[model samples]
Target: MAKTIFNTSEKSNFILNMTEEQYSKLASRGLIASMLLVPLFTIIPEVTDKASYAFSAGGLAVGGVICMILALIGMMKKYIGKGAVIPVIAMGALVLWGVISLINGYDLNISMYGYHNRGEGLLAILFYFGFFTTAAAVKRETAVKTLINGIVAVGILNSAVSLIQIFITNKHYQFVSVDDEAMAASGLSMSPIFLAMVLTLALAAALIGFVTSESKKRRILFICSAALFSFVIMFTYTIVGICGLVFSAAAAIAAVFALKAPKSRLVSVLAAAVPAALAVVLVYAGAIGNITSYRTYDGRIAWWADAYMRASASGNFNSDIINIDDPVDVYTYMNEKTVDIIQKNPLTGTGPEQLAFPQVRKVNDLTEIEDIMTANDGIFDKDYNEYLYTAATRGIPSLIALVLALVPALLIGYKSMRKRKSAEAFTAFVLTLSGVLMFFISCSSIAYAPIFWAAAGTACAAIEKPKKKEATEKSANKSVKAEKEAAEKPAKKNTKAEKKA
Candidate 1:
């Protein structure tokens, strides 16, 4: 009866399949592998017609399958308590709405996989939900810091790729560029805009590491990495990237002031102003334009199969969107169209991946350049805003579920941030806060969405209160220490009395 609940074989730590610690480590390994490898994926355009973007989907599928397995295993085995699953349940609701939307959708193929270049479809959403669940359900350990470190590692590698491409040789890394934008660097990601968001995520984690590190070497390392990530983020020229960097840095500085700020409040204020000042100078100098528009609307290639292979190979298909001259125009038109899409279906609007070619002039022949020039119905694929996009695609309840998924973790993370809790908790808060805000203003893609979800899951894990077992162990240890002190007190008193005598 003593150990029957968890049968263990001798010389093995596998109890009831695997311990919670092992489960979490495996999940981390899977997630870290994707974070490190997914963005770096690429293939030559000559190899396949869909070479520009299919590899990313392949990476998502590989990573998603692993995450899904871990999530299902954890759910079946009851790795986490019932109370810990509220955020996950919220995520499940998002998935449920997505499926329902898919079922009611006009085209199963389009809604299931989304547009070709931008795959924000139901399948991709399912994968992201799996990742969020895996991250949230795992029992967080001190080793959770590794996830932050992994982002830093990705930042460093991507920075190196971009730096070399900028100063040394642009022609060297053709595979790195999914599009032909020579002025900006995209690292191994699909586009510079998407890469910017990823670097922002890395920058936030590195800033946290910099603030919390006590050792001089570690501080130097984190600061250098943060600077590198931030520099590349500027080159990407995305508003969300720049804003996230400044906000996350400022937030981290505020939190760290509790530990080791100069007594003068003036010094603290100046310290916080530096990041803002840098951003201002960069924007004013015109070094940073809105890279978001570079990948903006009018991308003609939506679905490619055997039928479109010849058309694609013959150079009839233009995969990029028609670039608008002004970012304001781009945002305005997309937002207006998004509203129309939402209004049309109000409940589970248009399904996931339903709207690719907005107000199409010729829906049948989307590839021809002649047709694309005349038929500019704002060629919008994904909506600029994530909140509106979620509501438009999944419906009002799904949007509420999305909010529920974030709000509780956000609230807990805020508490952890204010209290200056453990490094893990504070880092989680920063990750979740910055990532969520960044994506709120941008589209949800596999490129940046996974990071946000992973952050949310990590935040969920980090902000949990201590368990009853740990509380009991702590009390027992304290009582033992108290008894030992009581027993020793008389001996010390008698010795003192003898000396006095």
Candidate 2:
């Protein structure tokens, strides 16, 4: 042995020591880092004077590229499960159709860069890739725990910032605004609605953590975080935010009970509804601000009417029915114009470029309405509803593709929640549910979309069971522990014998 140290044998042993399991874990950690970084990127503001809408788009693009590379590596190492393929394929189809539409319409600048104030054209496709990649890449329990911890940490930070902005600061920041009477604690997001959406998800995550955590300290911390997030949501004064919070809470309650007691699901659902009902009562009773004020209700009603009018060929079309200066009339007119464009190219859509620079009626429109239409520098059409926006801009096929992608994930999350007996599973389920709710309520903001996709991916990734190799490692660890104990026992006996001698 002293004479011979075989280099070939040493090299062979080193190569054999590197197992596939180790490679999988390395890839999983990389994906976890990317996922955690996305929320942080949402807070970065666009400081440049350029017409770019999202300052965070560059960060998102980089994160997306990194996630894709990590996902490919996971796949190569066979870390990703079979279930991850569905979301990947569905998202891929959506991006593929969007690109095809862009090519057919052939407006390179607008298609590639998107319109000012809305940087979600080509860049948004990258987000979906990031989402699918995360879903596919994460396969370990440590990875799941790390992702949940990251979400909770960010949520707590967001809540703290919003609270500080509302209470201490009268000045405005990138996303925070405080005035004499009205206060919008946008935190890291420019839009109050977007901030609300993020807070809603955070609240859900906090709640899940509270319900699932067994440790006393962790439970208390999660409860405090949940309360802070809830306070932030109310202060934000966004109707959509309130609605989403109520919906997610109710869903989470029902999900928890369904898993714990399937037979009591209905009772649990009703119990969950109590908090929302109480809030509404408080609003109507003037104990709190009226969430359903005439102004808010009327505006939503007007938009719905506008969507209906545009989607149909009814003879009841009356543009002058409402005052042109009114937001309803302006939104209706814009939506009607969008509908006309969608009808022409329902399959591939009018392309991202045409949708960005829509041709609206120049004459016989109020200056105020015209101003609203041209608010985005006459370069993009704005739709509050995500589903309608997708259909209008990317075509029905693209919308359908998105639906297909979401539905499976939603179903998977729902099923997982019903069977969840552990904290990790519950966190994934609640986050997924919160993301789905946000998609329905909030407009597709670049700041918020990445968080949503990351949540969805983590949820999908949580479904993977532990591998055999991990169990083998655990057994090997136990065997080593036993051998060490045996060696210690003999040493102790020898020490005693020496003492007696």
Going through the candidates in the order shown, the clash numbers are 2, 0
- Residue by residue across 416-492, what tens digits does model 1's lDDT show? 55664666667777788776786566667676776667777777763344477799999999999999999999999
If scored against the real structure, what TM-score would every candidate get?
Answer: 0.75, 0.71
- For residues 1-501, what per-residue lDDT tens digits would candidate 2 score against the true structure? 212246556455432343444544654455445544544554543223342234455555666677776666656555555665687678888888888777766355656655434456765676566656655556655666666666667667666767665556522321221111333455655445666777777666666666555577976776667666666666555566677568656655754664453342233233334544554454455443223321222222223221122111012223355442254454555566667768877887766634533444342444443243433322234455566667777788888988887777777666655564556666676667666666654466655666667667666664556568689999999999999999999999999999999
Query: Please, what is the whole-model Cα lDDT of each candidate in the order they appear?
Result: 0.63, 0.57
List clashing residue pairs in candidate 2: none
| Candidate 1 TM-score over all chains jointly | 0.75
lDDT of 1 at 265: 24
Instruction: State the displacement of the C-alpha of residue 419, model 2, in Å, after optimal TM-score superposition.
Output: 5.2
Error of 1 at 131 (Å): 1.6
